[model samples]
Target: MPRSDSRTRRSRTRSRRGVPLRKSLMVRLLATSVLIAVCSIAATAWLAATTTSHALRQEQGQVLARDAQVYDALLGYAATHRSWDAVAPDVASLAKRTGRRIVLTTPQRRTLADSAAADHAALPAAVSAVVNPLAVDSSLTGGTGATPIDPRAVGPYRLTAAERTALAASARSITGCLLKLGEPSQISYAPSGRPRVTTESLTAAAPVIPDVCGGQSRILTRPTPTEAAALHQLEGLVNPCLRRQGMSPIRIGLDYIGPQSIETLYAPMDAGRITEGCVEDGRREQLAPYVAPSALLFVTGVPGADTTGFALTGANAVRIVEVAALVLTVTVAAAVLMSTRLIRPLRTLTEAAQRPDQARNRVPVSTDDEIGSLAVAFNDLSARRERLEDQRKAMVRDVAHELRTPLSNIRGWLEAVEDGVAVADRPLTSRLLREALLLQHIIDDLRDVAADDAHTFRLHTERVRAAEVVEWVCAAHRDAARTARVALTWSAEGDPELTADALRLRQAVGNLLSNAVRHTPPGGSVEVRTSVRDRSVLIEVADTGSGISDEELPHVFDLFWRSEKSRSRLTGGSGLGLAIVRQLTEAHGGRVTVSSTLGAGSLFTLHLPSAAAPPLRRDPAGAAKDRRER
Candidate 1:
């Protein structure tokens, strides 16, 4: 019907039509479930593959470590022995410890020893390493840039039982002397039974050897007869090379410290290098006959074990795909069911909202979740709206009835005067003025109530004495009480003060006093009391009148409400006095309450916020009088 209504309807229609399937809650939920399922499957497959690959690498690494151990054991055996005659027991022990097949062969492929000979297992074509004492594997021996010859190949340098015992005793003596000098040292024997004095400081360039221990060093560092003979032979071989290089011949000792040569001072740095090369060559030649011949070392995995790398078979891959598909289907199905259950209640709410009769339309609350709570709250809001609609209708009727009565009286009096049937005398004029004033009062009360409803009611707040406000209102209404032959009185407990609108406070108190004076019988009394209670100033007006019933008490402050259902001005004054009092009290951030009993009186209380009282001023004359007494 209206342009805005047409536009709103069109907009709603467009929104409904424009919604796509992908944007739907159910579809999106299904998509999300599928995506999560896919990611989970992919992650699981990746983790499994990665973990398996790592385990395989670890297994390969362990196999390599065992192979190196076998190689090292065999190399040490060959280095010390002239032949492999006693190597069978050692080979079998290494194979048992390492869980591998160990086979040693000559360069001609003649099997020297085999741990798997009883099984008759053929040798692996590829060799693992070479067992050579003359040319050793430095990596296996943990050596860096040292001699290629294995240190175990001591040959003639090996000390006899007597020589070893003498060197050990000498080493113990040196260690004891070093400890007494506050320099701790330990005896460490080399492969040749040469006991050297080692300390924590020995790793440095200049080792600190105490002078007191010098005699012990001479005993320990002196080469034994067996080592002396070998060293003498090695020096003979090394001296020939030194002479060929034109460097002075140097004497060698067990410590390998040669005297500095003055003849080689002008030679290049290779002069020392040439001496080291000659020594290395001489030792290899001298020890060559004492060690076993070099041979190939063949180390294989556990007999009949799989040695190929890891691989995923075709069947396993198919199984993984099937499992992933199954997971996806179940996830999507569960998402569909869950989204449907969640959307069902929401659809019910939407349909209920779209209906024109909102008060009657209610969604069934079948759950205790947030959605069910929303339904309950919506039903409560609908009930409140219905009650307010009824109140609005009743308020319109009451306002009309209140305004029509005074208007009818004024019209009737004017029509009588114009028709020449009544005189416009002083008494008649006074009655007309009273009726007009009554009408104006009703209009003003309605305006104030409307202002409160619209939240525009304002109060100019100030600090006023509560006792004064109560006494002034009572004095203003005293004449009315006298005319009605009702006794009116006022009292105060203390000088209670209030932070409030003085005018509004008075108007509220006056309304209560006037109402009490009007309702009370001719001989009845109206009393006003002021006191402080709970940080609030209480101005209570209690009247000895025909009291309100319990049924009417709740609606006493309701606008356009009166105890007199007949709506007569004689019994009640426009049914708005108490309502205006409530509005004014609330504007000052205060509250008014009434308690009444049938056949007894009603007490109306205005509880306003209390203010601190001003300090009392001292009298100058009283101060002088007290001073003279002191």
Candidate 2:
């Protein structure tokens, strides 16, 4: 009774687990999809709100890199010209290329050249960079200002054609000598327009020649007359200035690439302060006739955007929010459409399942997706249920008919005795007892079938030698086999130890043995054999009997089913033996199978898992109870 209640509880539990408690599928799908869309939209809006200024600054950085080249071009023009008077065209070109307004002015804030009309009020407040070729304000150098002199415009120090030819000849002579001595030499030009003699073999001994060819110093300064005159004037201006500052006067070197590049008479670091204003005055005084005066370049947009500004505005923000909302709505719509399509089949299945008559209902599979696969599975389940229902009905009728015959026989005999129509003698009493026993046997078999279907059958599993079970079953059925005039034999080979329920195992094996012995004709043989095969224990019963036909073989394990559709005890017992055998075997996690020929013989094999067969191992009662609980 407890086992029956457990089975009922399990059935209810399974039914409860199949249903879910929450919103409907469509609502959940729409909620999840809309949430994701909303999160994405919110993230986009947040990023725009937080990073607009940073993005604008990054864009400005890229513009700065691009305009660095244009700045350098304009600086070169300023370096080689006398003033910004003719610079309007160049400034306009630079503005066009860089997509920015360009304005040039003197250090005194006087406008020099403007890409647009001279409207100083429209320009930005700060200067972009200074344009000074002589005493450069390093910001305009673009990090390549190793020398203050613009390398492209090398004023008076630039090499003439004759000077280059003379230098190249000298370099070739050095190259020839180095090559002869198995060394390397090349002539390269410096940005200052000086020929530099280069050699790969620094460790080699120098050739016997003039110091100019292979010397470490590459610059050979030959100042022009104009440069000489400028140097004299610069020295004259620097002495008085230094004396006024109370710093000692120092000797100067004029054979330099630029006006500020003075070879020092004192610490070079100290010379910067002494020559600060003096160098600027001297370079402009020297190159006044040669190049333009220093000017400040400014780049600007409209008045309000003098500084960097955010890219997002109120209208843009509204548009972004609108687009985000539209996306969320579309996503929700898609989720609803998809969920509706997906749940249609499930609803059909649910309706069919709710019907009282299940034998004729099936779900239609329209697609090959997971939902469609579920529909296919539902249809298969419905068909299987129909077949089982038919089998159950037939089994009920068979049980009724089987009990009716024996019951009628017993009742008739009793009634005859009661009416004094017949004597209640020993032979008559024995016949009545046999009829009662047959009824008892049918009832017991029906109970087993019910227990098996409910999955409440108990198995007291333990380590038992399979050979012992076989011997016990064979011994129990030995007398019956002898009475039927059939030879009963048993044999065992290999280790046949396994974990199994001993009473259930015996019942299942005994059923096979009994069936085999009954079917075997006189002078036939029934053998019970136990062996180990592929980590499993096999208990087989072979019989030389009236074997079953191919068409009727598959029905052998059905409840109360017989090959011959009759309840004749002479040819067939109550046909529940094989069914009980299968149920008990499966309850112990084992399998029973049969092979038969029409007339030759029949073999029934029981296979049980024996992978963990240990010698002298047993399951305690506690462990068995724990297993049952699990």
Candidate 3:
């Protein structure tokens, strides 16, 4: 049998499986807080960005529509004052009091002049490029020949200046091509503020109004009294800026819907024949972005815009992007740190656990968190490692000590004979042979420990005398007791010939007898007894020798365990003797027990499985040989 590596295997398992962890409580709490805070901030920022963009676009649209309204009114004022030189001068105040700008364009689609806003602001390039002032080329319903409206042939648009020019050019061009100054054109008027077109009263002229318009048409748009009142509201505004020009009070058409509905008013301008110039300009910054879409007007005329699109500003989008980027950066950093904090302690525990030496194995998990709990576990592992380590070292030291004595005796005498110090013949040879046999017993004891884990252990069951075997062991050891000058006593009850293995049964009893003789002093006594305890046969050997200490009693049968200060020291038997006895007994489905006092006597007990019946016949001579050798 080969020795098992149980100690090493057990050590490795303990080391690898049991390391403590250490993490700080405060650190864990802070990490948790950071995770929660970052998520909350990110969520809130997303919601805020979405909602704020929506609200800003809503507000910007309203502002754009209001601006469009002002443009519409200014065109009305300019046309109304173009006819009467007397009343035209008075209408200039309307432009000055509005805190805004105005453009007076001719019916021929020429800019007559401007109030503050247009005069100071430079026209956007896209607006400057809008040469087709009469944006529509058709008559009331449709047109044929060269005057047929081609909706795809839209002219340039004034986008850079927020299309102030688009407003002027759209109204000027549309009214010039579709309406007349004094003749009721094709447009049908609506009364009581409900505006509509009077298509029957319209006519057309070709040559599409030169560069100022796409064509010339006279379509009267339906005007209302409230629209006339809305036009009257413009009377006081245009004169302050236009009176010096000697322009006349002009006839204008106004369209209105609902009392509070928005109105569009139109006036005519003869820019080429004006006594003094009327000019319009615009802010470049406001119109640059819309250049492409605003250019869609001339071929299609002015679309009735009511701030048609939601205007979410670029600045608002930029802000949201910046905020989102910050949140993403913070979240990534937190996740990295969190994973690190979580994994650090476990790595330390792993390294510590891989160590082999009990003294060298320790985990540095001194934390107040989950890692701390791991630290505690590591401490437990360390203690267990220490215990097993001590047991291994002790077994090695004791086993060597037990084997050396008998081995040395054989080796010493053989060396003496080789040196011619002692004769290697007869009695000397017999003494050497006896010493060799004792050494062989020690080797066999070691083999038992080695084979303990193997699966080959089995008993050869047979029937033999039981009570007679006990009696015979006592008699056999009596000669050895006489040699030691120790009295050997024997007793038996229920003297029946029971079923048992003659050899193994004798071996268990002989071991107990030898243990008794080994521990007893020269004058001390050895006693062997047999009885049935409960259902099993019992054989015992008690000795008046230095008995086992209470503390060492439990470990008496451990392989190679010994306490020279206790009973096993004087027993002079390899400690494995009792261990082997126990093994053989258990192989027969039996048990062994022991009791002792420190300085008085000790009792060793073996309980064998009882046989159903005693042997009917037994070999007297063979049984006597076994009993005599007991």
Candidate 4:
């Protein structure tokens, strides 16, 4: 149970660990950008489909209207003459006029004036019921006991009577290609025809003559009222034939197939947008000649328009669309994934830069790219740091050796003084006292080095006047400069103001000046200069003294190190002068560097970083304290 509790605690702890990808800036940006891309694609597709549907419907309406005009003109021509032979020739003329068959059927359901084929058995059923009524009805009308030929005859007879009235109203007394129907209960076939006086009954067993209309009267027209405007719609979708004489029949039903719309209806093709809309509107329309339908004419009543019908309904367009959408989905997914993969490494590198203890300890990456190069560079840096640590250790050893020699001499002189080995008033006694002070100063310098390393070297860091510090150091060093016969001059520029511990900065600057004065031969001059350069302030101490050797130049600031320690016997100076200079300058967030030559003497440059003030921070030891307390 304890172990299980520990596991549960670990899981709960992980839930609170750092930032999650869902919360990260980069992840949120990635998701938002990808969603935008998806929405743009879908919206564009809908707009394209809507626009195309509107265009096709507009163009279709115009084609259908033209076909109607042609059909009406042909009928007018046939009503002027009373000949059956004339009907075919006129029908053939009209067929040539609109480049489509002009079929005429008699009331007997027999072919009378067909422009194409008399053998076509696909005559519409509604036409057969009207134009070729039952033989029982025919016998009933003529039988003596059967329902008398009364004017009150209704049902089919009433329907026929209404049509006859319409036919009579259409007859032309004055002929300039007009319809004429004199004898009733009949349908005639004469392309250029007049009303027949009373023809012998062969097809309909009576001296019953048909109405002469538009050359040949059609009791049941090309398309019943049910098929009126659909014929034009069919013409609009018709395939174009330059000859305009072939039967490119598209039997449009709920389930009928040929080369589908995308395959043949259009001339040139683009698979870019195949299936436009869905089966939410899946109705079939027999647009027999959808291509260049100007030559076709269909006289039909509007078939009950299934407005739900879609033009591109076949599996071909749907398949194409499905394939395109699938490819698009995959492409989008792949692009997003690839993009994420590319950024993942960069994000890792950024995290590594922020938390370098984790970053630098890892092995160098293996890749032939810039990121791999960066890893190699980091490895080189880590190695360099290790070497510098080794150098710092060597410096510590060197400092100890330098201090031990002076300390030993100081201690031996003190022990001898206690034992009264030296005679009273001896000159060596004065040197011995000075040496003891040097030893004490060196010990203090070592303490400063340790404190600097620990970052616990406290300073009353604040804004102080640099001019005041410089003047005081110069005044204190007046006696030494006079003893050395060196003119030590000081100058300040701008405000000579800076933020630092005043005492520390004064000590550091004084060390540089004193070091320069010590090295200068008699008549040699030391000048202290201060200036504000850009955002940083620079303090320089230059002298004409025997300069440092190239070999010892770099180690000038090392603790307890001095090129000429014996030269400062009167002042009882410690080799810690330059070392203290470096520590104090650094504590103020400034650096001290020396430029020297074999004979031209040294110039120490103090470069201070500009800062308004240090940021307020909780003591770094706070976290350690908390951990210890826990």
Give the count of colliding residue pairs in each prediction.
Answer: 0, 2, 64, 29
Error of 3 at 588 (Å): 5.4
lDDT of 2 by residue, 1-630 (tens): 357446434443443444242434445556777777777777677757655755676677767765676678877897677778899888888877766777888888787777766454666677788887665555645555444556544455445677667656655776776677677767667433445455664521223333434542232333434445545666776777778878776555433222232212112344775565555454445555667878888876533344565456565667668767876677778778777887788889789879837456876666544555566566655655666678768877988889989999999999999999999999999999999998998898888777665555677888899888988888898889889999999899975688888998898898888888878889999988999887778999999998999877877887787766767867788888998887776665667789999887899998887847432332334332222222
Number of the top TM-score candidate = 1
TM-scores, all models, native as reference: 0.51, 0.48, 0.45, 0.39
Candidate 2 residue spans exceeding 4 A from truth: 1-333, 451-479, 494-506, 550-554, 587-589, 608-630
Candidate closer to the true structure by TM-score (higher is better), 1 or 2: 1
The lDDT for every candidate, in the order shown, is 0.75, 0.69, 0.53, 0.52
Which run of 10 residues does model 2 get worst, by summed lDDT? 258-267
Tell me the tens digit of each residue's lDDT in model 1 across 540-587.
999899889986887788767787799888878888888789777766
Worst 10 residues of 3 by lDDT: 292-301
**Best candidate, lDDT-wise?**
1
Model 4: per-residue lDDT, tens digit, 417-525? 7799855466776877767676677677778766766657888877777677788889999998999999989899966577878888888988888888878889999
Error of 2 at 481 (Å): 3.7
Off by over 4 Å in 3: 1-338, 353-358, 364-404, 411-425, 453-456, 461-478, 481-509, 521-544, 565-571, 585-595, 603-630
Which lDDT tens digits does candidate 3 get at residues 184-241?
3332222121223222443222233222234221221333333445344444333322
Residue pairs in collision within model 2: 81-291, 81-292
Worst 10 residues of 1 by lDDT: 258-267
Sequence-dependent TM-score of model 4: 0.39
User: Of the pair 2 and 4, which is ahead by TM-score?
Assistant: 2
